[model samples]
Target: MKTAIIYMTKHGTTEKIAELLKSKLEPGQTQIFNLKKSKLIELDNYETIIIGGSIHVGSIPKKL
Candidate 1:
């Protein structure tokens, strides 16, 4: 199955978590995207889509 792991990190914590999660999944079947750097993400192509973000104060980033 194809998977997409999309995330946003404030201090790199979320990115590390995403990488860890990807490591447990099938090799070469998972891809990661950083919302702060990646402008365009095509979700339709992925069989499973995972969205992750870091919490700041009381909420996640607005860009998410």
Candidate 2:
């Protein structure tokens, strides 16, 4: 199976988590992106998608 992980991080923590997940699930297929300068590929490119948005101060980033 193939997977794509999309992440938005305010701190390094969320990005680290995304890295871990990618390592276990997709390995070389993992692609890290920041909301400020990130692009989305077609969802059909991968069999699965894992979207991660950081929650800070009780709210999630709207950009995710």
Candidate 3:
């Protein structure tokens, strides 16, 4: 099944996590998108969508 690891990161922690997920789920296909800078506007192709983000000042980011 095709999957997407969509995430937002301020200090790259979220991107790192996404990378880990990508490594584990390779051969399927995975890409990490920064919510603030990414232009991707659709999610129709992903059979499974994994959203992730990092916490700053003990609060979750808006992209989470």
Candidate 4:
């Protein structure tokens, strides 16, 4: 199955966790996207999707 993990990181913590999760999962079509840098992401392409972001003073990043 195709999977995608999209996240925003202010201090790299979220990026690290996304990498760890990707590594622990079984081998498959998995792609990680940094929302702050990604220009376009197609939600329909991935079967499984995960969205995450770091909180800054009780607020998550807007790009997330």
By summed lDDT, which 10 consecutive residues of candidate 4 come out lowest? 21-30
| lDDT tens per residue, model 1, 3-63 | 9999999899999999999999999999999998999999999999999998888898999
Off by over 4 Å in 4: none
Clashing pairs in 4: none
Q: Tell me, by lDDT, which candidate is best.
A: 1
Q: Mind sharing the TM-score for model 3?
A: 0.77
Query: TM-score of predicted model 1?
Result: 0.95
TM-score for each candidate, following the candidate numbering: 0.95, 0.77, 0.77, 0.91
Model 1 CA lDDT for position 56: 80
Give per-candidate clash totals: 0, 0, 0, 0
The CA-based lDDT of model 3 is what? 0.78
lDDT of 2 by residue, 5-59 (tens): 7888876787899888877774566565656567656778777788888778898
lDDT of 1: 0.95
Model 4 per-residue lDDT tens digits across residues 1-64: 7889999998899999999989976677889999888999998999999888888899987767
> Distance (Å) between predicted and true CA of 10, model 4?
0.7
C-alpha lDDT of residue 21 in model 3: 88
